[model samples]
Target chain A: MAKQDRAIRTRRMILLAAAKVFEERGYQAATISEILAEAGVTKGALYFHFKSKDDLALGVLDEQDSHFVVPDRACKMQEIVDAVMLHAYRLQTNPMVRASVRLAMDQKAADLDRSGPFLRWSNVIQQLLEGAQARGELLSHITPARTADVFVGSFAGIQSMSQTISDYEDLMGRVSDLLRHLLPSVAQPSVIASLHMSGSRGAVVHEEVERLQEHDPSALAVG
Target chain B: MAKQDRAIRTRRMILLAAAKVFEERGYQAATISEILAEAGVTKGALYFHFKSKDDLALGVLDEQDSHFVVPDRACKMQEIVDAVMLHAYRLQTNPMVRASVRLAMDQKAADLDRSGPFLRWSNVIQQLLEGAQARGELLSHITPARTADVFVGSFAGIQSMSQTISDYEDLMGRVSDLLRHLLPSVAQPSVIASLHMSGSRGAVVHEEVERLQEHDPSALAVG
Candidate 1:
């Protein structure tokens, strides 16, 4: 068990270093040597975890799905907002998420599947909207699938704009602005009135999610 | 005068070929040789038109701003819808526009300015919204700048999703869905009712613009 834990720790360290390198230099330009140097690990140790730079990139992409944990809400519309806001918060603060965004959007690194992140994010939003629809949280005209596509697409665009403009400093505000414009079309009037959409909302959601995770360890078990 | 016209035609041919190559291979991997071959021009001819691949990419990017011509409406909100739908139509059918979209979103092409498209799109939307607000066509709480950011971001995200899922075959429907969801929040109720946010709306706008362009050549003189 001690040996297993050490191996896991070392793997995590390597991934962290790789994310930094990729984020700084991009996927094609980022080198394993730089990643190893950054991690202060031997070449063999780096090779043990990530066989190639592509493997390291895939490892980073895989990390995109983890880390977000928004608690279930009575109004799933609000829960949907919470999920998006929490994601925006994480994108602003997390290097892994930022690196993954950069890697996913890097059109030159055509080896890995570019569609993975979009599909993953689309599914996440679809499931939440599905829940909201079942609870009558959605407006009459809203379809979960179409709305999911739009929300995921819009969020990706917003992240890109933020990346180019302020490097995610205004991501929270941009997200708040997004929810304000979009939620009205997706949610029932009562639900819309009750939900909070603000630039500062993501940070608030992040704190609430963190508190929930602390109270219930099961919070960390989300896929 | 004939020589000048031939020079313009040669320059246009090179840009179109470069856009196609860049679209297929992206900025980093796209080659001048491929563009030259695609254009069916000699190296000297290609060099005369564009000094480098970067210049060719910029030419492609600059052309992204053109080819959409929407006449102003009594309610500027309708004009905003026209602008978006016309863009969607162009994206579906025009190779230059599609290639420009790919290059603009290619995060790896960091040497060229990525913000040019976003800023241009934002400015277009902002000016439209400002006109709408001046005429009282907008909702009371809407701001042009914030809403412009969302529109540009959402449009980009939708384009990316369309590229991944169906190579933009459903881009028309997706843009329609986006406009429908967004218009209610931005426009007054009467103006919202007047808006045509449909999947086929882009094609319709394209036809109308073409007819207008035919009647008055100055219609194509937009900067």
Candidate 2:
């Protein structure tokens, strides 16, 4: 059992290191040696766990999939939006997740089947949209698939832009505002009203807190 | 003057050859020697025209910007939407444009300042929205910038998906329908009425013709 635990720990460390290297240097430029050095694992141990660099990259994808568990909480549409926004905010705050996002966006890593994360997230959004539709919280004609695509795509575009700018405060606010305007096209009037009243406030506060941490990590830690 | 003409022809040939090579092998994997061989140009000539591979890639970007010119016709919202739909249809029909689209999406290529073409196309949409706003065809609260982003983003998403699935017919129809529904949210009631009645016809015809051409390219060649 102790030996098994050590193997798992070594594998996890390798995945983390691989993700960082791939994000920073891109998949094409990143080397297994660099990953091994960063993980502080012996070359023999690395070869023991993974057959090739492709296998290791795929392992990193699997590790990311395992780490990103969507929370199952009951909430109104407004709360769901808040949760998603907060999740985006948290991804911006966490360096590992930030690196993962960059790796996912890297064209070089396109062969890594990075679609797994997006597919999972889309499923979550679809479920939420279906729930809203069943409760008549969505517009009668609004197809859940289309709504989900728009939501997911816009989220991706906003995330990509935010990463490029690194100005979380301004971008997050615009994202929230963009979502607010978009909701009315597919969401029920009442849901839209409720969202307008409370959704923006939650998003603003969440984003502000993230911005604070981003601006001064030590200050946030001290606080 | 004769030497200048040879340089221009050589540059054009190299750009075309580079586009093909880049499409097949992707930007990073494609080699300068291969591009030179394909263009039937000497290494010295290639170097004279372009300093390096990156310079050649940027030249491809410039060529694309100059080649794919959107028509500057003033029309109603529905007409504008039809034009957009037709533009997407042409992209589906043209292999070179499809390759260019793929190249544009490439992560390594995304770092290049290939914004010239995109900016021009986006400006056209902005102008359409601005015209609607001026004629009181748009809602008081709807901003041209936001409308342009949504329009551009959705179209881009549609094109991206269509390219992946090779399903242009249904995808284009869905995009057309989505835009038809979307315009009502921002446009005057009369504009919405005009769009539903006439827009549906143009969209259906546009998609049908594109589908036919897609299935049988010789049909277009014969015509």
Q: DockQ values for all predictions?
A: 0.52, 0.25
TM-score of chain B of 1: 0.92
Query: Which DockQ value does candidate 2 get?
Result: 0.25
Residue B12, model 2, lDDT: 80
Candidate 1 residues B1-223, lDDT tens each?
A: 6999989999999999998887677677678999999999899998987889888888898787855468756778888888888888888888888788878887667677777888888888898899889999988999899999999988888887777766788888888878877877888888888777778878887887788778865654242
- Candidate 1 TM-score restricted to chain A: 0.91
Question: lDDT tens digits, residues A1-223, model 2?
Answer: 7999989888878878887777666677678999988989899999999998788776765443344322232434654575467556656555556555555444334455555545555566777788777877877787777666556545654555444334345445556645655676777776776663343454464655466666754422110
Question: Each candidate's lDDT (Cα)?
Answer: 0.80, 0.61
Alpha carbon deviation, residue B152, candidate 2 (Å): 2.9
The CAPRI quality class of candidate 2 comes to acceptable
Taking chain B only, the TM-score of every model is: 0.92, 0.72
Error of 1 at B69 (Å): 1.4
- Clashing pairs in model 2? none
